[model samples]
Target: MRFKNKVVVVTGASQNTGVAIAKRFLEEGSKVLINSNVKDDLQEVYKELSVHYKDSVMQYVADISDEAQVSAMFKALDEAYGRIDILVNNACHQGIGPTFEEIPTSFFWNVLQVNLQGTFMMSQQAVSRMLKQENKGVIVNMGSNVSKRAIHNRAAYVASKSGIDGLTKAMAIDLGPKGIRVNTVAPGYIFTNRWEVLDEAIKERRRTNIPLGVEAYGKDIADAVLFLASDEAKVINGSRLVVDGGCSAQHMPIDVDF
Candidate 1:
């Protein structure tokens, strides 16, 4: 248990990659506070995790975009765990569908509010708490490969994730002297419950684009996050760890026959 006795906070911990990150941390013996905007979703995940983790897992419901709510969540964490050793900023607004020209202005702003502003606020609170502790802390932002390579119909998401890359670098430099490390985990084409609905042909066609011949699972991304948060990555900071099954390395999709 690399994280034994460590206190962790994972935003967007109710589903998909977020849930996976929280579970991995808990398994490694961290006292984790799981946050989600949906009360029911948070409770459901809490119920499942609490069954095994019991005292080590706690759940908090809040919209990360709201500054007050974000502060309240941290306050609750302070009361529960007293200190935070790692924070995984995994909550995000995907901003899927609709071309840039066709997308509504309100929808675009909402995406930024949750994806960019929310991360900013969450990290700010985490840093404040970390500053008071003797051990310092680590902040792992959930980024995307699309941040480096744009994807169709996800303008807001791409923009927000790209901003996270820049933010991670800036935070690393600013916090390094204070003993805080910051990094980004950029995952490409992660397989989640959403992919379960896609037809077999559609899934196969998607996998063809990846050189590894398989999409990343939530566990895959979780492993990267855990590594960055561990002592093993002591000097690693401001780096973007792409967990994309080599998707970003190729110029074009591999021709199966070639």
Candidate 2:
């Protein structure tokens, strides 16, 4: 139990990667606060996780994009846990449009507000709280392969993720002196429920493009996040841990031949 007695906050834990990270932290013996903007989904996950970890879990529903709500959420966490240890900024927004021109400006800005600004807000509060603690803290921001390489139809998501990489570096430098480690876990083609309905041919094509010939499960991302948050990463800071199965390491696989 690496995280025994630690208090963890996983934003956007209603489903997918966030939930997976929360589960791992709980399993490692941390008291966890699961968060999501969706009340119904949050309540359901709260109950589901509470079955095994009733005393170690709590649910907080707050839209991370809203500053007031973010403050309130952290205030509640501080009251409950006294001090924060690890933070997984897994909350994100994907704004996809048929074409660049088709995407509304508001939608684009909303993605930035939640993905970029939300991380800033959460980290700001977490650092202040951790400053009072003896051991300090760890912050793992969720990034994407798109942060390094651009993909079509997701200009907003691409921009937001790229910003996360930059934000991770700045936060690391600023907080490293105070004993906090900051890093990012960037995943590629994580197979979530949204892709469950995709055609088999499309899925196979995606897998073929990856060097590992497989998409990541949400747990794959969680494993990377936990590593960066653990004591094992004491000297590693300001690094983007690409957990995308070598997807970022390759050039175009189709055009090049061995």
Candidate with maximal TM-score: 1
Regions more than 4 Å wrong, model 2: 255-258
Which portions of model 1 miss their true places by more than 4 Å?
255-258
In angstroms, the error of model 1 at 54 is: 0.8
Q: In candidate 1, which residue pairs clash? A: none
Write model 2 residue lDDT over 1-258, tens digit each, in one string. 889989999999998888999999999999999999999999999999999999999999999999999899999998898999999999999776656788888988999999999999988988999999999999999999988889989999999999999999999999999899999999998999889899999999888888998999988888898899998888999998888878888888542544
lDDT of 1: 0.94
Clashing residue pairs in all predictions, respectively, total 0, 0
Evaluate model 1: give its TM-score.
0.98
* Count of clashes in candidate 1: 0
TM-score of each predicted structure versus truth: 0.98, 0.97
